[model samples]
Target: MAHRFYVVSFGSLGTPDVVWAPVTDTAFQLDFEESLWCPKALINDVLTANRLRLRVASRHGWAWADGYGRAGVSTVRDRTPEETDLPARLIEGGARDGA
Candidate 1:
């Protein structure tokens, strides 16, 4: 198969209830893409809002979530622009301010 990477979306990315999938790979992983999300629509609005800020509530005591998954393809990695190089750059890591 092809290369793959996991996505943790905020706003409306894979926000449960399976609304929209602008960037279609599969129902396995999600992206940090604003275009691929709704930003204000979610199964539970509060959970959606919280996730948008990356506000995770871990069992370690900081983040929480209803569910999470891996994009079903092959593997998962960073596909960010500056963080990656290529014709392969199409799936480069998300743009980071540090770059």
Candidate 2:
């Protein structure tokens, strides 16, 4: 049987918290709960206290779903010219560089 893949981003992209697990809900929930280390605490509590954020995505159809897979692919496009130039424009507008 084909399996679906789930990408869980706990903090930010490329961070160690970003993980891909198989079998949909079960795997993700198990891993997430383990990380929290608080079986009694609600998931919402962990999110609020740690500022934890999650982004989940899946590929259409199915390929394989087994244990945690690290070979998953995620691509990020480069910033547009306008986006890249925002910092310069802000600096010109009297905004401090690091502020």
Tens-digit lDDT track of model 1 for 1-99: 333433333343334442222234453333333223334465445323223222221112121121233111123242321232321221232222222
Cα RMSD (Å) per model?
A: 13.4, 13.7
What does candidate 1 score on TM?
0.19
Give the per-residue Cα lDDT of candidate 1 at 29.
Answer: 35
Query: What TM-score does structure 2 among the candidates reach?
Result: 0.23
lDDT of each residue in 1-99, candidate 2, tens digit only: 333334343332334454443334465455544433332345445432212222222222211111122122221232221223222232233222122
Worst 10 residues of 1 by lDDT: 57-66
Clash count for candidate 2 is 0
Candidate 2 RMSD computed on C-alpha atoms after optimal superposition onto the true structure: 13.7
Question: Total clashing residue pairs per candidate?
Answer: 15, 0
